[model samples]
Target: MYKLVKPLLFSMDPEAAHHTVSGGLRSFCKLWGGKRLLRTAYGCEHPALRREVFGLTFRNPVGLAAGFDKNAEYVEEMAALGFGFIEIGTVTPRPQPGNERPRLFRLVDDRALINRMGFNNQGVDVAATRLRQLKNRENLVIGGNIGKNKLTPNEEAVSDYIQCFDALFDVVDYFVVNVSSPNTPGLRALQEKEPLTHILNTLQQRNRKGGVSRPILLKIAPDLTHDQLDDIIEIVRETGIAGVIATNTTIGREGLRSGERLTAEAGGVSGMPLAARATEVIRYLATQSGHAFPIIGVGGIHTPEDAAEKIAAGATLVQLYTGFIYEGPGLIKRICKKLVAG
Candidate 1:
């Protein structure tokens, strides 16, 4: 069904296509037996596919990455497609419109996307309410991917993270501190040791203050040096956080086969272009840190083999965004079947 529609979706603007697909799916799921029909067609379940990571039990290790569901609007709609988890938001404390139009672009030749969305979201409170209202969340693992507002200065970034954390605490299963998106000006600087450590420590402090603390993970950029990764390892250990999401998106356009015009678009690139580097970061974090924490590997996964490679490279779990878009829903079941076969 997706193959038949891919060409039509491809003809539209990338961001507009995304909205159309999401809205269409939501509307489809609202029909009689729609969600059940979706589940019957796409859901894959096996004991072998189950995973226990970071004090949470995931029905499978495959998850929907953050940017796709930035406002928590499609949690149940996506859950029906058989993802083990779904991450929502690079949400901020205050609502802000994202970067200008044409911010999201598709590079069809390279099977990748370049987006400079600038963390546009309806604020954390709205997402929290949406999650809180979810009725069928029994086995679903939801993660809140939190970030600072674009207008907030770097010095005051910690407060924004804290506000998001607090607002989402009761609702989300885990928290991903998003300081790695390249679209946000000066946001990556928070990945530096002093400031990064400060933010994590502050969140950790709040996380422990409650009766039950949710696991917190740091999301890092794939563009980091070995030294920076070492700092990341040290920060994770020092902060006693749960784990790491090995990459956000990369600004580097080293080997893209797409034309110069699309390649020159300023933003982070994700999809097939990011697979090797993302897996490399996961392996580095795992080996360098002696596999001390879980890693959720996501980037360029368009097939079951790509998902398996991340697991083989020490990713406790894997996620999909671009690949999910390009490959369609069957990719999740195919990946679970592959994992079970092994």
Candidate 2:
């Protein structure tokens, strides 16, 4: 079905196609029997695929990564499609329309996408309100990936992160500090040792004060050097972070089969071009940490073999975004089925 519809979606603008699919799914899930029908067709559940990580139980290790539903609007829709978890946002304290138009582009030949979406989301409060209404769905685990607004400078970034952490404390299952998005100017600077430590430590302190603390994870870019990854590993240990999401997207457009003109478009590159490098980062962190913390592997996963490579490299869980767009809903079931078969 998705293969048949691919041409039409491909014909539309990338961002427009994204909105159409999201809106269509939102409407589809609203139908009386829509969720049931979706699950029957695309959902795959098996005991063999169950994973217990970060003191929480996951029905499967396959998750829909952040940036897909930036405002927590499609948890139910995505859950029905068989993802064990869904992460939303890169949300900020205030709502800001991200970078200019034409920020999202597709590199058709490379099966890749270049996006500068810039954490555009309806502020933390709105997402909190939306999430509060989802209390009834106990099986779905939601992760809030938080970031600072564009105008917010790096020195005061911790406050922005804390605001989001405090606002979403009651709703999300885990927290992902998103200081890695290239589209947000100086955002990646927060990933530096001193500032990153301050943010994570501050959040940890607040988490401890709460009645039930939620796990916190750091989402990093694949463009970092080995020395930088070493710093990240140390910071995770120092701050008691739950784990890391090994990679956002890459700034490097190395070896893509796509046209140079399109590849030259400024943004982080995701999809097949990102697979090996992302896995390398995951393997580095896992091996360097001696498997100390859990890692969510994401980047260029279009097939079960791609996912398996990440697992073999050390990812406890895996996520999909570009592959989901290209391969459709069945990718979730396909990956989960492969995990079960193993």
Candidate 3:
């Protein structure tokens, strides 16, 4: 069914297709028995696939990475597809229209995607409202991937993150401080040791003052050097954050068969080209840190082997974005089946 539909979706502009598919799924999930039917077809339940990480028990380890559903509009719809977890947002304290048209590109030949989506979302408040309305989220572990507004300067960025974290703390099961996206100007600067440590420390201080302290994780970029990654490991330990989401999309475009025409696009690249380096980054962090922290490996997992490879590399859990787009919803069930078989 998806194979027949993929051509039409692929024919449309990438971002437009994204909205169309997401909207359609949301509608479908509202229909009578829609979720049960989807579960029967795509859900794989097995005790071996269940995982306990960061104090939350996941039905499985596969999660839908952030940026697929930037807002919290489709949590129920995505959950119906059988992912153990779903991460929403790169959301900010305020809403903003993202980068200009033609920002999302499909490099079909490479089975990859490039986007300069600039964390476009309806702000954390809107998402919190939507999350509060959901009645069936108990089974799905949700992570709020929080980021600063594009207009916010580096100096005051901590305030933006704090506001988002505060707004979403009650709703999401966990939080991800996203400072690695390449689309936002000066956003990656927040990933540096000083700013990163400050943001985490401040968030930790706030978490300690509260009711049920939710897990906070750091999401890092794949483009970092070994020294930078080492710094991140130390930062994780120092701040007492839950863990890290290893390897966000890369700015690097070397050896892409997608050619200069598509490769020349200015944004982060995700998919097959990212798998090796993403795995390398995961391996480096896990080994060097002596597995000191939990790492959710996410980059270019399009197959069961890829998921297995990430786990072997020491990822406590794994996530998919580009792979879900390329392989369809069945990918999660397939990956879980393989994991169970092993």
Candidate 4:
């Protein structure tokens, strides 16, 4: 059904199609237990699919990754589609218009996308307001992924993270500290030991002092070195943050089936080509932490086997971004059903 409608969708701008899909979903869920009926039909209900991690009960291990619903606009719609959870936004403290137009692109031949979206979203406060209304829904776990403003100097980035932490503490289930997006200038530099520790520790401090604390997870880029991954593990232990998201998108273009110009496009590449390196990162984090820490595996997870490989390699759960674009909502049922087989 979606495949037939996809060409019509692809004819429009990527962002426009995203909004259209979200609006349609929001309306569909209003149709007399429409959300419930869709979940009963499309969602996987096997008990083996349930996994507890970071103080939350996920109906299944598969979640739609952040950057899909950057402002919490379609959490209910996505939940209706049978995703166990959804991560919303790489939201900033203050809303910004992000980069120029045509920032998102699709390469159909490679089943990949290149985006320099620059975290374009409504600020944390607006997003939190939208999210606070959805708290009572079932089978819908939302993770708030936050980041610094584009204009904020890198030195003062922690303050931005702190602001978002305070505003969204009561709304989201888990917090993904996003310092790995390639679109934001100098954002990846925060991945270094000293800066990363400062941000994580400050957020931890605020979380402890706040009325209610949310699980804080650090999201890293796959482009980091082994030494950097070790630093992340040490930081997690030192700060006692909940878990690690293991990866964001990567700038590396290795092993792409598409030609030079597609690879040469200016942005982060995601989709099928990201699988191996992302799984390797998950394994490395597991090995480095002695499997004591939980990691959410995300990258090129397009099939049941790709998801199972990440779980075996030591992911507490898995997330999808580009795969969701190429494969449609049924991908969740496909992956979760396979988990029941094992």
Which structure among the candidates has the greatest lDDT?
Answer: 1
Q: Which is superior by TM-score, 3 or 4?
A: 3
TM-score computed on alpha carbons, candidate 2: 0.99
TM-score list, all predictions: 0.99, 0.99, 0.99, 0.96
Off by over 4 Å in 1: none
Write candidate 4's Cα lDDT for 277-329 as tens digits.
89999999999899878899999898999999999999999998889888888
| Candidate 4 weakest ten by summed lDDT | 132-141
Give Cα-based local distance difference scores for all models: 0.95, 0.94, 0.93, 0.88
Report the Cα RMSD per candidate: 0.6, 0.8, 0.8, 1.5
Ranking, lDDT, top scorer first: 1, 2, 3, 4
Please provide, for model 2 over 17-38, each residue's C-alpha lDDT reduced to its tens digit, 9 standing for 90 to 100: 9999999998998899998999
True-vs-predicted CA distance for residue 313, candidate 3, Å: 0.4
Candidate 2 Cα misplacement greater than 4 A, ranges:
none
Residue 196 of model 3, lDDT score = 91
Tens-digit per-residue lDDT, 106-127, candidate 1: 9889999999999989999999
How much does candidate 3 score in TM-score?
0.99
| Residue pairs in clash, model 3 | none
